[model samples]
Target chain A: MSRRAQENLVALVVLGVFIVAIVMAFDYGQRARMVPLPIALIGVVLTLWQLVWQNIRPADELNIDLLEVLTRREGEAVARNVSSNFDEQSAHQKRQAAGRESVACGMVLLLLGLVWVIGLLPGVFLFMLGYFLLSDHYSLPRALSYSLGLVVALYLLFVQGLGIALYHGWLEEWIRNL
Target chain B: MIDAIVAGLAALMTPQAMVFMFIGVIYGLVIGILPGLGGVVAMALLLPFTHGFEVAATLALLLGAHIATIWGSSVTGILFNVPGAAKSLTSCFDGYPMTKQGQATRALGASATGALLGGILGAIFLAVSIPLVRPIMLALGPSEYLMMALWGLTIIATFSEGSLMKGLIASVLGILIAFIGMDPVTATPRYTFDILYLMEGISFPVAMIGLFAVAEMMKLYVKGGSIVDRQMTEERSTVWQGVRDAFVHRWLIVRSSLLGVWIGVLPGVGATVGGLAAYAQAVQTSKTPERFGKGAVEGVIAPDATVGANEGGGLMPTLAFGIPGGEGMAILLVAFIGLGVVPGPDMLTKNLDLVFSMVWIIVIANIFVTIIGLGVAPYLARLPALHANLMVPAVLAVCFVGAYATRGQIEDVAMAVAFGILGYLMDKYHYSRANLVIGMVLAIMIERNLHLSLTLYGSDFLLERPVAAAMLAFIIVTTALPFVRRWWKRRKLAAAGGRA
Candidate 1:
């Protein structure tokens, strides 16, 4: 997708969220929805405006600031010197970046899943060790050492020092029951 | 007052109080460096240990930990993009960028020193303002508070970056998200989706951990580099440079500290709001406003100073009116009760010496934190220079674990991950996460206060309240000034071009 298309898609998603919120807000009491309803309506209007404005403008001009638009005359410089820090990349590089982002996202989900299934300590330990090993960032022994040291530190700080009851995971619960 | 001040210093001169203060500062710093834990947690954890200790020692431990956490949280926000707590979120805006430029030690030094100066100044202000607090507190109403929240929202323009529309939308979305919990006015759950956990609303710290910390790690994984470039790290600034930066920006520090103290004096207004407000004021007042959110040292200094001074401001209501300023102050109130220190008008006349002791603790503890912060800043600055592969997992683990640790809920971990994805997408697109956080911070305050203002004085509340009316006018002028200035500059340039 083009950058403009991606921006439009996100804007549309935001618009949809506001619309859904406004609809759901009506189900509440008058006092309950008083603040939320107006806020959501404002959100919808702002987002819809963003969607329309981004789509209508040329790709280069799409990065225009609203404040500048309000302040400047017609055909005046609308693009503020506000850098968004986005760099231009080739199609191949974009694809490569997208792939890396997907992997990163997947790793985050995998860690989350691991934590959910096997509790925080074991989950974090496994995730860290796997990441260290798979990324070729550390030797196996070093990875093991780092992971163990972190888990031990977590245990001492949270479990012992603070007296927090960490989640023992569904797998641990099942195994213990069996 | 002089006698009480001397008595306060003499009381804290005890070896037990000094030792406790040291231990509390260290513990607070450690907890503050952790992603989810903040001063409240540090103080709450030490509550049980407060028993049977001397009054000075007990207050030292509790208040010292609270003071230390302000700098502790800024350390992470500066070095990593991960804020230790919501109050430090503004620090991450410029502090992390400074880190990326390998100026992490400088950022840390400025943050610590800003806090130290703010703390001392706030302590002095607290002592001076004690006699004048009650009428000031009574003079402001819910309408004034609502205006203050609106004033906070007006600064969304500062963080809008390139797109005010997108920034407003992000802030609106954040406000909507804050409405997910049970409504304070009507007791009706607004957007809970019937989930039991949602009734309590989203945990601010958990969402913050996911938004900044987890999101940054994901970005690191994709970008394939350390947070600070190796080339940049070689030319890193010294800690003294940062300390000097804080002093050079002394006027900004004083202004931000006063703002912090004022916000602290207001009941239920938190350091989170104070920090963000300070940042907003910094941006608004700066001649080169464009340097903010991109490694302006003032951006780092303003918020840290505000947060540091906030502790002293927060104590006023807690000590004077038996009303806690914020959650940390609430916990301190609990400790005060245990220590047999009554908080009311009597507290002023009877326990004036005790109040002075707490003030002395704030000043002394801040000095200790700054000393320790400067000592370790060089080593802490090197953490970001580690390879992305090592940092990604290490930070993510801490973030997820910290998210769970926040409320001891597994669901908060899931919430953190979800927000992480949202944060990454928001950053990828041009949404202002800072605006969103500010929106979230002020939403409940605005909503609750608006309801109260409406109920108490009806719709014409602003007209009825002179202070609120003035604040509204101030908000309008400040919010419009930048656009007006820009337009005037552009017109002048256009005229110059025609002549040329």
Candidate 2:
């Protein structure tokens, strides 16, 4: 997708959520609904304004951003004063960023799944090793060293030092019983 | 007052209390340097150990750790772009840029000194203001609180990434996220959607980790570089330069420190607002406002000073009216009760020395943290040069675990991942995560107060509450001041050109 399309998609999603929230607010009693209803309505209008304004504005002009000057850093004045349009490689960069982000976020999800299934110790150990290996961050021996060291330190700190009863992996529990 | 100060010094001078205070400061730094863990978690972890300790020792440990975390939280922000806590988020604006410019040591130095001075000023302010605070606290009600929250929301004008509309949208989204759990006044779940976890609401720490740490790591992955990839400058900015910078901006430090104390006195405003407001004020007042967010020394100093002082402000309400000021204060209140100290008007009259001891702890802890922070800054500045490979996985591991640890629920990890994606998208677009956070922090306060105000005064609350009405007017005027200034400047330029 083009950069603009991606940006629009984000705005549309936010607007859709607000619309759903507005509809849901009606089901609540007067006191419960009061705040959410107006907030949702205002959100819908603001988001719509953003979407429409983005499309209609000149490509080379800056958006009528409220915090434009306030957000600028020392070197950013020149860059920020200009319009936020697609640079020559913006779409390409955006695509690459999206892909990399997905992989990174996917790794986090994998860790969560691993923790739920295998518990904190093994899950953390495996995830770190797998991430380093898969992402080509380190060689095999180095990855193992870092992962093992981290896991041991965590075990000492949390289990031994802090006396936290960590979740035992199902496999470990099964093995212990056997 | 003199007796209280002497008594406080005497109480904290005990070997056991001093030792515990040192240990607490160190432990607080460790936690504060980690993602999603802050003084709250640090205090919570130490709560169990406080049971058998002496009141002085317990206060020393608790308050010492809490004070240490204020500066400790700025470390990650200075070294990497990641803020160790929400209060530290403002530090990253100029701090991370300083790292990029190889001035990480200087930034760290300024942060330490600024925090130390801020803490001292805040303690002094609290000590002096105690007598004056009772009437002010008594005069304020829900209507006043609501206006204060609205005033806080005006800060979104400064923190937004670029577009004002996008910033407002982000703020609304943040407030909406805060509405996920049960309504404060009604007990009805607003947007839980029948999920068990939703009933408890989205964990702010978990959300913060996702928004900042997780999202930042993803950015690192995409960008493919260490935090400081450029060649190191041979001319390293000395730590003393930072100390000098803090002293040079002494006026800014004093103003921000007072702002922190003021915000701290207001129950529920918290250090987050204090930090952001200080930054906003710095930007608004600076001759070189453009230098902010790009390694301006003032940007780094102002927020640190404000947050450093906020603790003293927070203690006033808790000690005066048995009303906890913020989350950390709420936890401290619990510790106070455990220690058989009833926090009320008598706290001022009978237990005056104990209160002063708390102030002394703040002063002493600040000195300790600054010493430790400065000593480690040069060594810590070397961290940004570490390869992304080691940094990314380790940070992510800590973030995920920290998220889960906040609530000990698997679902929190999932939510962290989800919010991580959301945070990334927000960054990719123009949505301000800071604004989102401000919205979330203030949402419940705004809603609860609005309800209370309406119920008590029957919709004519503005007329009924003059203080609140005056505050609302102040908010409007302050919020418009920037735009009005810009327009006036533009008009003057145009008139000059026409004459020319």
Candidate 3:
């Protein structure tokens, strides 16, 4: 998607959230919804303004500054400068960045899933091992050593030292019940 | 007063208290450096062990660690753009930029000195303000507090450098997010949607960990570099330069410290607001306001000073009226009761010396933290130079575990991840995450106080309360001053161009 499209998508998502919130506010009593209702309404208005403004303006002119708007400053020049700085990257580079961002997001989700299924210590250890190996930044032996040593240290600090009962994971609990 | 001061010093001078103070400072520093663990956690963890210690020793340990964490949390925020606690969030604005500019040591130094000076000033204020504080506290009602929270909202303008509309929307979203759980005023769940965990509301630290830390790691992975550029790994400024910056901006430090103390004195207005307010004041007062949020030393100095002095301000109400100033002070009050210290007016009259001991501990603890902070700053400054491959996974691991450690709920980890994705998107867009956090911090305070003011004095509360009305006027003036100045400047330029 184009940068403008992405920006519009985010604005639309925000607008949706505010609309949903305002709709849900009706379910609450007067006191409960008083603050949230007004705030959500403001959000909806502001986001709609943003969506409309961004669509009408050129992509380069979309960097609207509240101060500039209030002061009626030379906003076009400022917006162009700001947008140009971010837009300096080539389309190819932007695509590459998007790919990397996707991978990063996937890795985070994978780590979260691992932690949920296998618990914190073991999950973190496995995630680190997998990341270190895949990233090709460390030797196999070094990755193993670093992962083991760090996990052991975490175990000592959180479990032994602090005496926190870490979540022992769904797998551990389920197996124990069986 | 002189006798009590001397007695307080004498009490704190004991070997037991001194040793415990040192240990507590160190422990607090460690906990503060870790993501999601703050002074409250540090003190809460030590609470179980507080049974057998001397009163002086126990207070020193609790208060000392709390004091040290103020600077400890700033270390992470400064170096990595990952604030260890919400209060330290302000530090990440300029501190991380300075780190990228190879001035991490200097930033660390300034932060330490600012914190040290703020702590000392706060301690002095606590000693002097004890007797005079009651009337001041009584004069300010919920209307005034609501005005203060509104004053904090004005800071959203400062963060709205890119897109004011987006900043406002982000802040509104943040306020809405704060309302997700049960409403305190009416005993009704506002937006839980049948989730049991949502009944308690989102944990601030957990949200913060995901927003800044986890999001930062993801950014690092995408960028394929360490936090600091390889070319900028060499230190550009010394720790002395940072310390000197703090002293050179002594007036700013003093103002920020006073702000911190005032915010601290106000019940429910924690250091989070104090730090942001100080930053707002700094930016507002700066001649070159554009330099802020782009590695301005004043930006680093103001927040640290405010947070440093906040503890001292926080202790006043907790000791005198038994009303805790913030969460950390609330924990301290629990420890106070455990140690047989009854906090009330008698605490001022009968236990004046003990109060002085706590003051003395703040002074001593700040000195120790500054010394240690300055010593390790050069080494700590090198952390941002690590490869992204090593740093990303490690930091993410810590962040995930820290999120879980925050409330010991597995659901918190999920919340952290969700916020992380949102944060990444927000950053990619022009939205200000700082404004959102500020909104979250002040939303409850504003709502609760508004409700109380309405109940107590009706809708015309602001008009009825002269002080709150004046404060409202002040907030309007301060909020408008920058825009007015900018407009005047632009008008002059336009006229000059036409004349030329």
Candidate 4:
């Protein structure tokens, strides 16, 4: 059955085609549009050419298992750390997809961003409290200690030390007015 | 020269300077011990505190912290085999082995000494090389520097495991990503997707911390396994023996410093490469090559020397040419500009003394960092074996804070986490993250330089610049040499198999 590798290849091919359409649409950009047009044009060309070559290649038939294929490799090679479990490699690949959720990455980022817009104390408080309640990384005492440490440290650094403006959230506003 | 040395010696003698030196060294060690934090990160964190401070005191604090981190990283590598930074990779080879043999103290001591020695040698080279730096830098044209950058990138293919083609693709992706911000020559956005933040482009530190630091933290959380038990054998390791191992490897320190300095002199390559390359070269030439990655003192010394040399070498281009040597140094160069220092021959003529003073700072910082680093390593070595749960929460908090503090943007934190997951997948899949980082770092320069050369001279740019043509030829030859060697080896192996 066709799997993730095939899907990735197809996605890349489709992306290449899409970029080519962008390149074509932006062909007029070189003449009329000045800086970004010409700059992006070169990037589009290089990216499209690379994607097509990588994805739409005639992959020669080999004895290598489809599931066990490594998309990339790095660092010093060792004798044993490499996965040699060919029999259930496909299943392992499926399991590895959980990593691709990448939601945790996005969520953590958004969480940090949200704090800046609101205020540091509020941000830290919300983040710790949220994690304490929601995440498996919770114990009431630990969360309390963490939250207290985070809030106090941030207050010391950004507030007491740097003397930068405290994030003007509702709590901060109330404190200021009081 | 006489005046410069006397001034430097005077600077080192100040009580305040000595105190800050210890502070910087210990700070660096602590920062270095934590995974995903390196000298660059530590220095960046310390940069804020440097404002309005006395120059010598500031340098001591900064350099001390930076030097200590290198030693700090080796602690993790030796006891747990987790590299603190890319440079510490080789430490795992010999470090962990010595640890398993219950020689953790000795290994830690040796690493500390190596770091101290390497730091001094690198700083000395930096000091001696200052006067000659300008002429060499002035001689280096864009074409030659471009070739140098390409040569560094080609090493990725040599180092990468599995398909070179895949590594190339990853590198290209990295270059393309590096293209995400502003075009240097034209000052236009290339791939900012209409975001204002994209206009300035992504900060290198933010990207690095995220890609290396945040992503790494996430991996640790998911893996749910501590590679070391800090609780096991908390007895103080032999300190004097580690110190003895250092003296035994004196020649190795000089050899590694030269390696680091040579690589550092290149425009784009910096301390990380110098450190790892030093480690690799040390291992390659060792009598017992097998002993690397298992806590060989050379692993620590080689990287430390290279890192110090890289700082000096990186300064060469940044002061002479306007181009930066590496990311962290690039920021420092910007600070120089903020202080109204221009980077050209004129500045060299007018500010030779200030340049000498800076060189002096590097030397003094290294000496102080070493003393502090050696003194602190045994104490710091005790940290890694702490329960993962405790370390994880605090470290995770720092990761978030560090990511946020870098650019003051939360998206960066997210980017780091995404990159971390990507890093983990890449790590597991055998994809070279170093290639990705290098590609990301150098991509803008390659594109911008090529664009300038093209725009300035059109397609006949190479012919117009004969030096460029020659450099291009060099780049082609260097890139091709690896494939040729690979092909020959494969052919020989296949022929032997056939004959059998």
Candidate 5:
């Protein structure tokens, strides 16, 4: 997606949240609805204003220097031209980042699932080892050692020192029951 | 006052008390350096151990750790652009910028020294103003707190350096998120969507870890460069230079510390507001206000100073009126009740010695933390130079674990990851995560106070409450001054150009 489209989409998400808040407020008691209703109403207005403004303004004029008026400092010209939506990167770089981000998000979700199924310590150990190896940043043996050391340190600090109860996980519970 | 001070010093001088204080200071620093583990958690963990200890020793352990964490929280903010706690968010404005410029040592030093001075000054202020603080505290009500919260919201203007409209929209969204859980006043859940975990609300620390630490790692992972650009420039400033920077900005430290103490004194305003308010004040009052949020040393110093002094201010409500000023104080109040300490107007008289003991701990703990902070800063500055590959997984793992350990719920880990993605997108889109955090911080306070103010005083509350009226006026001026000044300058520029 282009920068402008992305900006509008995000604003629309925010506007949707406000609408949800307003709808939710209607379900509550009068006293409960009192604050949320008004706040959400204002939120909707502001977000709508932002969305309309983004659409109306030309892309070149989007970078409004809000701080310049506030500071009034000399020689420290606030770079008003910097666009949040458009970075100085090639299409390939942007694509590469998006791919990496997907992989990263996937890894986090995988870790969460692993924790639920196997347990925190084992899940963490496996994730670290797998991540290091998958990234091709370290050799397999090096990944194993780093993951081992991390798990040991985590066990010592959180479990032994703080005496926090770690989650036993679904796998552990099933094994125990059997 | 002299007698109280002497008694405080004598009580804290005991071998056991001293040892506990030192240990607490060290423990607090470690917790503060870690992302998402704040002073509230530190106090909660220590609350169990406070059961059998002597009152003085217990206060030393709890208060010492609490005070140290204020500066300790600044460490990651300065070094890595990741706030260890919400209170350290303001420090990241300039602190991280300084790190990128290879002045991490200097920024850390300024933070430590500022925090040290602020803590001592705040303690002294509390001691001297004890007689005058009560009536002032008693006079303020929900109306006043609501106004103070609004004042905090005004600082969003400072953080909205990119786009004002986008900043406001982002902040409103954040405030809406804060309404997710059961309302503190009416006990009605707003937007839980029937999820069981949503009943408790989104955890602030968990959101913060996602918004800052995890999102930052994602950016680093994709960008693939050391956080510190050592090739561009060598370390330009030393740890001692940072110390000198703090000393040079002595008046700024004093002013920010007083602001912090004032915020801390108010029930539930908390250090996060104090930090942001102090940063705002620093920017507003400076000759070169634009230097702020861009590695200005004053930016680092101001927030740290406020946090340091905020500890003393927090004790006012907890000790005198039985009201917890902040989350950490709420936990400490529990410990206080467990220790058989009664908090009331009578605390000013009967438990004066114990009160003084807490003050002395703040003073002594600041000194200890500053010494340790200075000693460790140079070594800590090197952390950002590590390869992103190693740093990314390690930080992400710790962040996920920390988020889970916050309430022992894996769902929170999921929430953190979700927010992490949200935070990354926000950064990419210039949607001001700082404003979002501010909105979340103030939402409950603002909503609760607004309800109480209206119900109690009706529609004409502004006319009835002079203090609230004055605060409203202050907020108006604070909000308008920037725009008004900008307009005046633009007009002058246009006129000058026409004449030329």
Candidate 6:
């Protein structure tokens, strides 16, 4: 698939899954009912709109060029990118009319769920430190120092200064209270 | 007034209050200098610590810290072209340009003094607005608040810079995030999906830090960059010229301070709207309007004044009605409740002393902040130019600590990290993150207020209420005004072209 179709397909798949989850959440009493009612309706509408718009709408006529928009902020850069991409823009529009599968925001939610699994401190410390080192923000020595410093500061501020209990997650909570 | 001043000074002069005020001011400046975090995050983080302090002492810390951040944010925006907060984004327009022009010292000085003057005048407006607050609170109900929020959102049209649809999309996304927790009216979990931690909803500070701070950090990493520009032009001007410019733009100070106070008093508009509205007004009123984005001193002064004034204005509703104006004020409201001060009209009559004490804190904090802010102007202006190596680790550590401090939840830290990556992507992609952040901040208030209005008055909420009707009309006008101005300018340009 071309890039636009690819992007829209991703959005639609996510919205489609959300519609289902929202439908399921309709049973969470009156409160949960509020969410699914509007969310499902909106999700359905957005998905259908995405699907219909992409099928009928000619891409070249559209003002927004997503790739060009992403690559630059200035108007001239946009114009330059658009001009350079113009010849292939028509040819790239030809794409597979078959087999497509889409996923949900399940990955995002899974990330959150795993966050709870690891507990707050270790999970966050590792995530931030790992992201830093992996992303090449710092060398190993620097990343370790930064992460360790952040943990110490956080401990001092929250645990020592404020005296609040930290989130231990369900497993940690079970282990500690037991 | 003199007697009130003396009494206020006496009440504020304690060693503890003085020390706390100093600490809060310094802390606020540093926190503001850090990209992503703003005044609200600083206050929220400090709130959990102020639990045991006396009212005066607490105000010393909270009030001082809040005032000091206005300058702190502007300094970064001017020196680095990277705003410390969203409101300071406007400062980047002229500030960075001036920095490029080798007028960094003048620009830094101007922003600092503007903050000082703007803050003092804003405080004055706050005190003057006090007597009216009681009746104002009484006249306001949920319906009025809902209308007020609608009016607040109209500002997005004004702030969209150009594209209203993109801004609207950004705002809708914000509202979506705000709706993530339980329904305010039905107490329903709107989008929580049974996660227990989602019960209280995403802490506004956590989301804000994640959206801005974390995003900035991620962008720095992805781009392989430093936080500050770290370039030097010959420092050609004395700091006092900027100081004189502050006094020179005294009227703008008063005007923007009033704008800030007016927005602040409304009890939900907060500094984000206040700053943008003030900048918009400053640009509208400037004689040499073309100078605005190229380092107009008044442009710097206007937002600073509004930021100060906003604090005082925010205190009005927060103190009078026990209704917080913004996230920062909400924390302040909680502090008041913990101290056994029942807000509303009762605060005016019974706790008049305390009310005046807060007003005094505003004046004293601004004065202290100004002195400290001005003293450090020349040096702090150089932070953005720091080597990326040192800046990256220190800032990342501080930001993580900030995220963790909110709710004492590690998930918040992860959220910050994830959002940091998102923020960097958004910045790279040319989507206005400020609009997105504002949408997030205002979304909860909008959703809650809308839910309350819908629940209370049914879906025909505005149809029955006069204030709502009037506000709706006002929103129509304000929303159209920006577009009308833009269209008119376009037409005028076309007409000029045709004539040529």
Candidate that scores best on TM-score: 3
Clash count for each candidate, listed in order shown? 0, 1, 0, 26, 0, 10
DockQ metric for all predictions? 0.56, 0.50, 0.60, 0.16, 0.48, 0.13
Report the lDDT tens digits of candidate 5 across residue range B171-257.
Answer: 888888898999888898778889889999999999999888888887787677678768886777888999999999999998998
| Each prediction's RMSD to truth | 2.4, 2.9, 1.9, 6.7, 2.5, 7.0
lDDT of 2 by residue, B141-184 (tens): 89998887787788776555656778899999999999999787
Model 4 CAPRI rating: incorrect
At residue B7, candidate 3 shows an lDDT of 95
lDDT of 2 at B402: 75
Q: Give the per-residue lDDT of model 4 (tens digit) for B1-500.
A: 66766765676667887787777776676667655567777777767667675665666676566656666776776765556765665566567667655567777777766665665666577667766765765665555555545655655544443334344545655665665666666555656667877777666555555555555555554554343444554445676788887788878878877767666666766665565556655654565543454346666566666665666666666776767777656766655654556886654556555556566666666666556655665665565555544444455565655555555665665566666666665554444565676677556555555555666677777778787778678656654554454456668989999999
Kindly list the per-residue Cα lDDT of model 1 for residues B267-328, writing each as its tens digit.
99999989988988888788766677778999999999999999999999999898999999
For all candidates in order, the CA lDDT equals 0.88, 0.84, 0.89, 0.59, 0.84, 0.64
**Candidate 4, superposed: residue stretches over 4 Å from native:** A1-139, A150-178, B2-4, B26-115, B161-163, B227-256, B262-303, B314-360, B378-388, B428-430, B452-500
Candidate 3's iRMSD: 2.9
User: What's each prediction's TM-score?
Assistant: 0.96, 0.93, 0.97, 0.71, 0.94, 0.74
User: Which CAPRI tier for candidate 1?
Assistant: medium
Q: Candidates 2 and 3: which is better by TM-score?
A: 3
Steric clash count of candidate 6: 10
Model 5 residue B345 CA deviation (Å) reads: 2.8
Candidate 6 local Cα displacement, residue B393, angstroms? 4.3
List clashing residue pairs in candidate 1: none
For model 3, the docking class works out as: medium
What is candidate 3's lDDT per residue for B457-487, written digit by digit as tens?
9999977899999999998888777677777
Prediction 2 TM-score vs. true: 0.93
- How high is the lDDT of residue B273 in model 6? 68
Taking the tens digit of each residue's C-alpha lDDT, what string does model 6 give over B272-329?
A: 7677667766765554444555567776777777877788888888877788987788
Candidate with top lDDT is: 3
